[model samples]
Target: MTNDIIPVILWCVPRSVSTATERAFMGKEGCRCWHEPLGDPFYFSSKRQSLRYSEEECKASGNWDKDIVDVMQTLLDPEANNVGTDKKGPVKYVFVKDMAQYIIPRQTLEKIHKGQGSQCYRTDGETCGTSRCTGVDSEGEIIENPTVIPTALMRRFKHTFLVRTPTKAVPSYYKCCQDKMAGFEFFDGAEAGFEELRILYKWISNPRSTFNTDKEDGPGAVSFPGKAQKQPLPPPLIDASVLLANPASTIKHICDQTGIPFDPAMLSWDAKPQAEFAKWGAYHQGAENSTGFKCEDDGAAKTNGEEAKIAKLPQEVRNTIERNMEPYEWLVKRQTTFA
Candidate 1:
């Protein structure tokens, strides 16, 4: 919570090798790494936005009561215990890796603005703002829609992004869905997440204009409680391909930008299952099994197999990739590059 404690978040697209990126920072001195803390509220909360799981499945997953504010408070608390690891002390940096879509899904934002009420459907089939709900504030006032985290809370952290080519990311994500998420065979195009990342990037660049504007002037604009300082420089963006091709230089460049000292040890670590990633099942298997950054297609068979998988993608999946390319390229052009 002190001004000296640096909080950094790596907002990423799914299957962008983001978990591996988090792994690079795991054992660094004075660092605390959190694996998708916001994911609990986004996917399992009573007011959850995702329909990927059934009501029973969501409740069975864990307690779905915590909201965005609770999650942020925990991350920013200097005395809080670490989620997955026992490393604890005076923290110098708090690093989080999470999918941007989990923070604020594009469709959920659209639905809320269209005056359809909260998209939070409870397990009992009740909407969030109804009489039986807990959507009111402590003073018994209707709580405003939490479509996005408040601008003030967002500014607490130094934000960065991790992106992958849609052609590659889309197919990779589809495979994860098939392999990990039971009964979810087809990819949910909404979860491709480029649009949410674009919105967040623009918001972070100029939050005052994006969040403080009149409802008629900006899409999904809301009155936030605090002023958002205009960022003097754009936050760093890391392309997954670039990081894989040059792990040391790319990670060092990121460290320089984010105020962390570059360490050679970040490039390699022992292959061990991370306790934090266990909650998400096998979604992070590659990262858990990796000792260091390596080309995903290290073998000829892998190269050919990945190509064949991409070629056989369903039409909807292909369309999702096409839709995301514009945003993906926009992010790529702005990514931090190393010689």
Candidate 2:
């Protein structure tokens, strides 16, 4: 509404509360949800022309090219895709949210601010657009719709990036594969650096995801919040053992980073519905099995309290999340308050 043209780009790893975030915005009136630019019911549709995509496509689009974002947006343009153009609801905001962007590269993202023409296209093969590109599966069989034109579709609207915890990220990515939504070979031959992802995840969820946008650590690299803070490197960012050893300090640390006001929502006694397209299905029971915030001041390795059920996940889960959330860390921190 501010004429500022804030093309909000909502970003998240699969099953990382993306839909929940989208729903929250939708509820605010002025927003229209676009599901994941590439997810569900339609991506796997047996029909050739359902005009749908799943997060998996975005994941496998080769490199996490910044142009991929622009191209994807271009493909979603109502002028190109013909569906999103006439959309209307309480919110006129355009959400270019999808879990797949996490697997892409920094240069590709840097290109996002530049505009189209930077995108790499399917030059030799038939492209996906305007009755031109061929709509084929990985094996080359034509599907119902034509090729998916990332460049042509997404160029029509504004963009933003929403991000979250890395611990939740890998779990969700794995779950997407388990549910037949994606493939185990998705990351095959790709630049999947787990240690790097762990750092990126924590950084992005700090509400400053974009502060260091268009930047990357060369190698053997680590980024701390400030120049003065000095702590030896280890499993946990700020001396995990030391911080975890003190719960109160841990909570304060979390507060310092995320800027998300601690809330009673973390201590809810209500049951939570099964997460849609969630990788943490093992933790799911049903909507009736809702749980509430159980934040406590217990002295433990996870310094954060009961409100940190999410902030303080098991180490193994946290490790998995760090490994997978290499991409899109900026958005992760930018919207740290939603949960």
Estimate the TM-score of every prediction: 0.77, 0.35
For residue 90, model 1's alpha carbon misses the true position, in angstroms, by 2.7
- Model 1 misplacement above 4 A: 1-3, 81-84, 105-147, 181-186, 207-232, 296-308
lDDT of 2 by residue, 204-266 (tens): 322223222213322322221111111111112222122223434443333233222333232
Q: Write the per-residue lDDT of candidate 1 for residues 1-339, one digit (tens) a residue.
A: 453667778999888989889999987877889889887888777877676667797788774777866787678766663444566566677789987767664344443223322233223332234321233345543233233565456655678888998988898888887785434565677677786676566555442442323223233223322223223256778888888888898888777777778899988988998888878777788888999998645468977886687778887677778878998988788776556
Give lDDT: candidate 1, residue 166: 90
